[model samples]
Target: MARPKLQDVAARAGVSVTTVSRVLNNRGYLSDELRARVNAAIAELGYRPDGIARSLIGRKSGLVGVIVPSVADPFFGELVAAIENTLADRGYKALLCDCQENAEREGEYLELLQANRVDGIITSTHNRGVSGYERAELPIVAVDRRIAPGVPMVRGDNRAGGLLATRHLLARGSRAPIMITATDHAGNDRATAYREVLESEGLTPRVHAYGYATPIDERRAMVETWLSGRRRLRPARRLPPRRGGAAG
Candidate 1:
């Protein structure tokens, strides 16, 4: 079946093609009832505007490329959700690319997004040394990590967060607090802050680097070893322990 076109929408709504175009572009004076009729017909027909043609004419794709390491991670899930919602609120669409923190895949996605002519890019990938972003000629912003030398970054105060977390654990009677973080550069500041806060309290700080490629079983064994050979914890077998008190 042929896809519905603007003429079909105009025919369905009993309006001129120019009038439909005006309504779509929000040009000229239009009645609320007439706009409702056009929209109702569009919804009934399930007709969508041709993004390519619109982009060619308007010089804007109305789309933004959003690249992330993994949406399955809780932090990333919330971040992507917020990004998509904010893009929709601004009348733009999100083209999400999940690279699973792989450098090659992230490079490919950068090329793909540029080829798609996305109006802008918002990336949270932890893949380092990928130079595709540096050469891109479009607007690019990073969240929580650096993509290139001059890229603007939007991140939280990791130092304050690390201090607050360490102090909280200490207050709760945690004698031994270890930070098991990924090898991402974004996490380096937190570890530094952790060491600083612990040293301030005359406590030793233990920071272990757990890369993303670590297998589940290997990670479990490593955690067990870190926790002073304690029997593996249940339910959270796959996660690292954040705080512990004298192995008790």
Candidate 2:
């Protein structure tokens, strides 16, 4: 069976398609009597305009895209929940893209959002230097990640947060404070801030990288070597075992 169209609704309502379109678009220039007649015709036809099709025609979609590195972290979970609620309240639907720390995949998702004609993007991705995305024509707001030059960002001051954490640790009498950060760029920023603060206050900060090395065969060999060293460094049982579990 052929589906009904706006023309059908307009014909049924005894009005022009332009009038039907205006009512559909809420332009509200018509009398209440005509508006009610159009509404009745629309309801009787069980008609729903394809949202994507309509958006393409108007060049505007009430859709927002979001990209994040991972969703397992508590911080990201709360952020996603809040973003969804806020966007929902504003009559927009959110499309989420989880890149899982894959830069190429992140780039792919960004392009996908562009292809989908998302109205705006809220991203927490790290691959900010992709030329294709850098030149993309869309509204982008980076969240929880460093925004590249010419990109608008909405996030807490991470460098200041790092310094605050480091200073708090020092004030609490931490003789040796070590910061374990993952990414090279972000870690560098935090470490640089920590160093500047430490220098001003005659304190020193230690930083360490923590991650599993990759690339197949080389990674296996490195893991085996680390396991062997760990075994060798195990503390030896120096004294005889005590009879009681509580010890004398």
Candidate 3:
């Protein structure tokens, strides 16, 4: 048999389709009597609102969009994979959007996700400027980044990590140690914390923000170069080799 439509439910309830829609959307001011009648009619007809149909009417898609700056980075690749797996387990599918660090492309992706009726979004560009992300009306969760207002955030303490790195360098008796970091909107937070701790101990902090490659080995090589440069900057002011010190 053909399934009942919302109009059928509304007619059975002696109400208008608008009223039925209001009841379904939880919109409008409905009296208790009308609300009960609508629900009872819905139960009697065994009618279910077609999510796809409603999305068409409401201009929404029942998809979740996930935007990552770059999936080539192992950290983001692993994070996206885990999120996708979890969502799949729960019977939800995800739309992966890779922006490749292009702000214009990121904005376009957000628009595209919305136009496709995405119910929600997850973003890893929280560490960067998020004005485009903030404009989206869908429920957004920032993974490894935070920018949208009232959105749930999931990540580690960047400031604390910076402090730990600074102290570790200082403990190694490297007074003029330099920090190598990526150039991002959030990168300064760690560098700021690093500076505060070093300045407190009457030491200067050097920060290098360039040449950050995605591959782990390349990143390690870049870090090594930064460390070597720091050593040359202050070959005389050195601390003894740290062996499980307080900072370590």
Candidate 4:
């Protein structure tokens, strides 16, 4: 059987195609009786409007692209979930793309989203120095990552948070607290604030930076080695050797 169309619904409802369109789109004044008849005919025929056809006419795709570094990461996962829920409430659908922190993959996803003609994009992936992003001609909201000029950005107060943490650690009797962080220029503000706070207190600031591209096990080993070295450098506390045990 042929699928039902607007013309079929109009004929079954004893109305013109214009009337059926008005009823479907809730445009113009419609009598309750006529609305009921058209709705009943649509229900009886199981007629559904084609979204793509409607979008083309309205010039609104009603779709939003969301690109993140990795949804597997808890922060990005929660952020995406919140954005999706907000978009759903606004009757917009989200097309999600996880770039997995790879720049090439991120670029590919951006192109894919543009090709799909999404209404807008919410991106948490970096696009610095990447071409084509500046030419997308779409409304883009950047989350935590800096992009081309004129692109709006949303970010947290990293510097204030870092200063607060460092001050708390100093108050808690940490003589030489160090700030450990990934070696990303995006986080330079936090490191700067940490150093500033230490300098304000007339104490030297220690910092340990690690590469994010390193494997997790290798990063952990590096951290362990740094901790061991710090421990070795600390002043030794001497205690009497045990009576019946090996002495030092």
Best by lDDT, which number?
1
Give all candidates' CA lDDT scores.
Answer: 0.81, 0.72, 0.75, 0.78
28-109: candidate 2 lDDT, tens digit per residue: 6789999999999999998887788978988988899988766654456678889999999999999998777777888898
Per-residue lDDT tens digits of candidate 4, residues 1-248? 89999999999999999999999888999999999999999999999998778777877888999988666555677998999999999989999998766778888888988877789999987434556668898899988767878889899887787778887887897756777765545547778877776666656666887644455677789889888787766432334433443211
* Residue lDDT tens for model 3, 197-229: 766665665677642235667777777887777
**Deviation from native of the Cα of residue 76 in model 2, angstroms:** 2.1
Worst 10 residues of 3 by lDDT: 239-248
By TM-score, rank the candidates, best first.
Answer: 1, 4, 2, 3
Model 1 lDDT per residue over 29-128, tens place: 9999999999988999989988888787878998999998877666778998999999999999999998877999999999999988899999988776
**Residue 79 in candidate 3, Cα distance off native in Å:** 0.9
Tell me the spans in candidate 2 whose CA falls farther than 4 Å from its real position. 180-188, 191-248
Error of 3 at 163 (Å): 1.8
Model 1 ranges with Cα > 4 A deviation:
11-16, 32-37, 40-45, 163-176, 184-187, 195-205, 211-225, 228-248
* Candidate 2's TM-score: 0.71
Per-prediction TM-score: 0.73, 0.71, 0.63, 0.72
Best model number under TM-score? 1
